[model samples]
Target: MNTCLRPVAEQDAAALFTLVDTHRAALASWLPWVAATHTQQDSLAFLQHSVAARQQGSQYDWLILVDGQLAGVCGLHSVSAANRRACVGYWLAPPYVGRGVMQAALQQLCGQAFGPLGLQRLVIDPALANVRSIAVAQRAGFGFEGILRQHLWLHGQPHDAASYSLLATEWAVRQPVQA
Candidate 1:
């Protein structure tokens, strides 16, 4: 099995901070939420809250690793037990770009969501301009749903996003069990 999502230990905060800083400026090209985070303190607080969220059992954090290096993070930002759904998000280090590391991580996360989280569907919303991210979803078996007009404002302007999704059944059929 792929070890994409693992526990984020307290010691990993430093590396996490570094990653946040290294990509904080340029990452805005694809991620808008990151612009608000401008300092190491901001990232530390984010991680602290994330840890607390995990303990409360309503959320979980997955630190993505590629070739024994920290590549990115992914997790269920929100979860509903009765509704059987969760909102998923992820990002990767620039160095790992063009590789299939994110693809493998996506498959692993999808399996965890469908299996342990009892989620019926996993959804992703990527900005239309973010071709790289949208491509990742396409490769991961998420079919385009539709565009959400002016879904979010980013980099000082409103932007539309293309919604993509994959159902548990679809995930089951698409996952290639690694030998």
Candidate 2:
């Protein structure tokens, strides 16, 4: 899985729109934003917001690329510098699911968050029904905390989410030793 995560750019709006649209039904089942993004303009606005958030040091958003093609999006959301923590979120095109692409992208982000960003902890909260996401979190070494009852409101309905976290110390312990 030749995958990489790069900062989202304004020029990627159309490509991003296509990726989302191609998997609209699959994505809409879990992500509220998918339904709201109807056109390229909407995608452009979303990208613009991501850029602004990065400029403000509030969040970091990236586009997942596989073999130089847009595969998905992933990022650290709700970054709290004072708390040294952040929340993670990600989604992939239907065709890219189950291919270890998202996992690789997530691992790369984890390194950035714990290394250069100096964050103490990172959390991934996926709806309890999102088995794939939960699996990714677990595989990436995030410890399951507990189910957050009614933690997310998607499509105007409440949904239960499982909270998972990895601390900087835990990440350090998981890193490979250099000879």
Full-model lDDT, candidate 1 = 0.80
Error of 2 at 43 (Å): 0.6
Clash pairs, candidate 1, are none
Cα-lDDT of candidate 2: 0.93
Candidate 2: count of backbone clashes, pairs at least 3 residues apart or interchain: 0
Question: TM-score for each prediction?
Answer: 0.89, 0.97
- Writing each residue's lDDT as its tens digit, candidate 1 over 4-81 gives 667576667788878978877667677766776776676777778888987886777789987567888888767776
RMSD of each: 2.4, 0.9
- Least well predicted 10-residue stretch by lDDT in candidate 2: 94-103
Candidate 1 Cα deviation (angstroms), residue 80: 2.2
Which portions of model 2 show Cα errors greater than 4 Å? none
lDDT of each: 0.80, 0.93
- Summing lDDT over every window of 10 consecutive residues in candidate 1, give the lowest-scoring window: 1-10
Per-residue lDDT of 114-167 in model 2, one digit per residue for the tens? Answer: 988889999999999999899999999999999999999998999999999999
